[model samples]
Target chain A: MNILNGSAYPNNGVHLNKRHRKAKLFSMLCSLVTWLGVALLGVLLYQVSSDGFKWLDLQFLTSFPSRFPYKAGIKSALVGTLWLISMVAFIAIPIGVATALYLEELSGQGRMNRLIELNISNLAGVPSIVYGIIGLAVFVRGLALERSLVAGALTMSLLILPVIIIASREAIKSVPMSIRHAAFALGATRLQTARDHVLPASYSGILTGVILALSRAIGETAPLIMIGALTYVAFLPEGPMDSFTALPIQIYNWVSRPQQEFHQLAAGGIIVLLAVLLMMNTIAIVIRYKTERKYK
Target chain B: MTMGTFRLVKKDCINNRGTRWGESLIHCGLALCTLISIVTTFVIIAILAKESFGFFEEVSPVEFYFGTRWVPLLEPSSYGVLPLVWGTLSVTFGAALIAIPIGLASAIYLSEYASHRVRSIVKPLLELLAGIPTVVYGYFALTFITPLLKTVLPEIQVFNALSGAIVVGIMVLPMIATLSDNALRSVPDTLRQGAYALGATSYEVTTQVVVPAGLSGVMASFLLAISRAIGETMAVTLAVGATPNMSFTLLESIQTMTAYIVQISLGDTPAGGIAYQTLFAVAGFLFLITLLLNVLSQWFLNRYREVYD
Candidate 1:
């Protein structure tokens, strides 16, 4: 239409302006959609903080749960969470890192090796509750471990093992092939190279990954619930075999109760959970950045 | 001289019995360690097969699948799983409805528009969403979201599907956004430049060129997120109602398969009873559904995967 008239420049200007306006509006809409996640986080934090602060006190952190919300505390839950995480870390790190090392370095590309790789990825995708069922059968009944911290920790180790292995593989994979070859050229054995150079260089990456996986393990409730972690435990675990209740289970128990105070207590429990999660994530991020700088 | 040095090194490597012995031992150990995952899968399948088969023996497969009700605890129990399936699907459907568009849009913005500074800030913050415990999300739903929704929809029940679905959607948003962002970013820069050279707008370039190129990955992300929502137990157990009703209404209380598992587990059902068998049966069904979706996601990822180096 503009080509037909030699002096139709102004009309074309208006047409392009219309399109530009529509495009700008559409882009703005996309930005709004992008903010949905941030918006949800904002609301969640605000809601929890508002309800949590009033109930969050030293006493609340130190005392045991009571029928009276005013007297209830998360001492047992906090202690149990710490015990569970420590046990999980103890059980998962060595095996997870070893599996990654074998698959990435030592193992040949055999059919069996490929099978292990496929199984690990598939296991990573399996639901946590299924892991719980396995725990119920193997740990609780088959092994006769019962609903103890040891069983829960062992189950969680299984749940997070694939995650840690996958992450460690990524970390190990990032180490330059030149570094290992250089070590080999210097008469360092494969084991010596991996131990002396490769493992040291990738240690931070492995740590960050393990920390992140442990954070995920900490928040896990389903498998633990499936394995029948006690919800009303008023005492802290004294040993690995002792029965335990985690923060998530404690919060779940509280939320189910009909009392308004218990709901407040649940909110308070969330604040603690979020804080622990945030701290772990912060440490992971710091480790990741530091390692990245060193490597690069 | 170089050959002599090489021979000495080779001899040293060959003669290091301790190192050779230790290395082989370590290799065997690690290889055995890696087999744990395979054993775990076998154990899960064995347990599910054994227990679910028990359930099927007691309650016929025809009735279990075709029956409309799922009341295992009540007298004269009905084994129809449709109600539980309906409950689970409705929540999943609701979550997908809420997650897909917003997640895609967020992916587009992050991949196509956000500067590095903004991307770094926003990306981690979004991940923090995934990092928060689901139990907290459940608490948030029960306490905050439900009350907030009550203002808008006065008739909504305290334990309705809407709140659970919305929170699950939020929980899933990070997975979709992050995965889809990677997908969108994987689209070659040349494609965007080609679209721009054709005088396409930014939105058009994204929706038509980049998104189409990255469709499988985006679709894979959706599949993965749906599987996640289906298997999610705690938040749904808390926010979605526990009653095993046949109704699909978002406002009514309903129980999902995961929720039902939690219900039976929480109750003191006698060991090796029918109630116990139902837990395994429901879990087996849930496992199959999630496993199918996961395999589908992996297939899409491998089949349509693009490499632009």
Candidate 2:
């Protein structure tokens, strides 16, 4: 209609304005949507902090969970979480990093190798609960670990193994191929080349993945539950063979109780879990940012 | 060449050959690491098959597959799994409804609208949401979200599926946003430029060019998020009740398959009994559906994703 107009200038300003208005509206909506995540985080933190702050004293951190919420603490659960994370780190990192490096070598494009690749991807997508089932069957019952910390750690290791492997693979893949090729051109063995160049280049990346995996393992409860680590032990675990309850499991037990005070106690447990998670995430970000800046 | 140089070269050659044996041994060790994941898959399959097989022997396949009743623990127990599957799907569907649009919008906003500063700040914060444990979400759903929802709608039960759906939606939101952002960011800038040259608004360029270009990835993100929701255990178990009612109503409590597995696992059913075996059966079904959704997500990206140089 504007083009058909005979005047030098057409009168479609309203139409153009409407289009611009729509664009502006959409831009605002997108910005709002983008911040919804951050918003949710803020709200969640606010809610938990409000509910749990009264119970977040030093005594709460030192005492074992008791029948009374006022006396309850995260001592046993926190220790178990630390023990579990340490065990998982010991078990998952070396294996996850090795798998990533082996896959990156591109040694043989064999059918079996491809199958392993596919298997890892599928494992990453498998629900964490399924890993719990596997833990129940193989670790708890089949191996007769009797719901020990070893069984829980082994199961948690498997649960986060795929995440670590995938992240490490990505990190290794992002290491420019030219670095490896140049090392090979220098007549260095694959092992030597990886050790001297790729390993240094990818260590931070691997650290980030390992931290993420360990953090996931720390927060994990379902697989532990499936493994029947349900003992409400007022005492700390003495060994890997001892039964344990994790922070998340403790929180779950607390939340299930029909008392308002127990709910507050669960909130306190959440604050501790979130604190640990935040610390791990902060370390990951520091490693990532430091290395990223050094490279760039 | 001098004799000294000749001897040094010979020694180097010998050293290289000697270490080759050690290198191959290390290589085998690394290869073993890769094989562990494969072994894990097989063990999962074997366990599921063995336990579920026991369950199927006692309960007829027809009833287990088609029967509407799911009273695995009661007298005169029925074995139909349809309601549990429906409950799981209903929650997944509701979660998808909440997650997809907001996640896509976040993807678009970060990739197309937000400046670098905002993107960097918000992305990690979003990840923090995903990093928080599911049990925390459960606590929030029960204490915060349920009470909040009840204030608005009084008839909504304390253990309704809506609370579970809402929290699961929140739990998977970061994942969806992050995945879809990658997809949208991967769409070549040249397409956006061309759309701009054709006088398209920023919104138009995103919706028509960018989103359409990253269609499969966005769709795959949706699928993966849905898969995550189905496997969500703690939040649903705590927020959604363990009662396996056949009702699909949002106000009524519903038992999801994950919730059922948690129920039986938390119970005192003997390890070898039919009730105990039902956990594996439900888990096997849960695994199959989530696995299928995952594979479908992969297939969507691989088969339909638009490739740009």
Candidate 3:
């Protein structure tokens, strides 16, 4: 309040101050709520490290899971996740990007494209576990893929397709129309314009989106669980056709065990899982930084 | 025109003609890739329909939908799915109870109060929290949260819906916070300035002006987060018991639809049996519920969104 206005309206000072005080207090409460999330993360990190740090060793990385917690490791799960994600990447990226290109550059604003857009958004909202239901029915049962690594890969590809497509479409959309117009003016077809000019310009953005989405796929357990990936495995997956387990699956298996030591192993597995996720995210962030700076 | 220019133009037309045919074919192929998502949806519907058709043929739809008990593994199994539905709803409700206020408050702080430096650090860190695997959340719930709850609330079971709710709430917090933050931020600065010029306090501007403007987005986030909580599997499966108890008590063990499906997959439940069919049926219901919520959320976001350029 202005000093002259406050003097003219005597009680206004106390009332205005009260309102300001309430606003300050409310802002503080909001800040506290924000920090609550950080507190949760801190406590969780502390909990996992304290319980499982001793078990996170070289042997833990290399050895196969055993009935005994002392010998149990995430070896099979690690390799299996590697196999799954590689196939997922190999299968999903091209198809997803192609879909994004079709929708963003070619389809334009047609009714069909709108339907597809709406469908993808709906698909993105479908729970990961429901995708597992399809994976179970179509791949595991119908195709008789029998929980193979490739089966898991295909399932995950379908699950993440909507996300990848959405992200890539956003990336493609960010490539302004002027670039495409320039190419077209130079006698290039729409395809040529998109491929030679737009795609290259948006590559980093698409890569970041892909990495972030794949990182999400890494942490997903429900669909893999729904497809009946084998939890108990002594050996690693030999090939795409072999049965496989993943990081989340192994963590789930260990967690469900009644033993306290198994929970600890689960924590160890989580640390590894989170490390992989963050590593990918870090790559995405670095690429984003490089791209942002380049554009600037 | 000169013969040289005419010949060059002719060659260009031929090249364009050749590439145009190839381009259309490439376009169709890319279009097929886009159609794959639609195909996935149809395939999901078809598989659930074909498998669940048998179950519906055997058990009356009314009984399956309205029945309270859900004992698929045991002989003389009651096929009532209300228990599972109740379980899913109760956990989702409980999770919303924990997530909404905290999420809304955090979103306000993020969009309104936080400095750019704080946001730069906190936002990505919040995403990291969201990125954590559900299985790990399950483990945390089992190893940490349930035990901690037990210290004060001794009556709580080792595997109870309460802890399941807490973990699910944590799991979805980032989505609510991030989406609502975007919503609030999208409410243009002019509105806040107008309120401030009218002598409204910052809190009044935020709670009254900014929040009302972004209500649709906040509501959409809530819907999506609730849907996610319903569909969450490993955490609920691990944190909550497998007992399909119809009682809605948070302290007691109950099984969600997701947890029930996981239970079937884990057990030696004979494939192609009624029990297995029940998995499809339950999953079908889950698909519908989440699908409806997703569509509604999308509709709300598109319909009511204030596009301030």
Best by DockQ: 3
Candidate 3 global CA lDDT score = 0.87
Please give each candidate's TM-score. Answer: 0.93, 0.94, 0.94
- Fnat per candidate, as a fraction, reads 0.76, 0.77, 0.82
What does the lDDT read for residue B183 in candidate 2? Answer: 95
lDDT per residue as tens, model 1, B1-309: 234323433433344455467666665666568667666788888899999999898999899988998878787779998888888998899999999999998999999988899899899889888889898888988998899999999999999988989989999999999999999999999988976776666866777778888988999999999999999989999999898787756887889889998888898767689988888888899889998998898889889887677
- The residue-by-residue lDDT of candidate 2 on B1-309, one tens digit each, is 134323333433344446477776676677668768877988898899999999999998789889999988889889999889878887888888888888888988989998899889888788888899999999989999899999999999989989888889999999999999999999999988887776667877888788989999999999999999999999999998887877757877999998888888887667899988988998998899889999999899999989899
Off by over 4 Å in 1: A1-18, A293-296, B1-19
Q: What C-alpha lDDT does candidate 2 achieve relative to the native structure?
A: 0.85
- Which residue pairs collide in model 3, if any? none
Task: Give Cα distance to truth, residue B90, candidate 3, Å.
Answer: 1.1
lDDT tens digits, residue span A1-296, model 2: 11223241244354667767888999999888877768888988999999999999999999998998889898999998988888988999999988888777634555555666777888998999899989988898889998899999999999999999999988887888788989999998888887788888988988998998888888877888888876487888999999988899999999999899999999999999999899999999999988862432
Docking class of 2: medium
TM-score of the second chain, cand. 2: 0.92
Query: Per-residue alpha-carbon lDDT of model 3 for B130-180, expressed as tens digits?
Result: 888888889889999999999999999999999999999988998899999
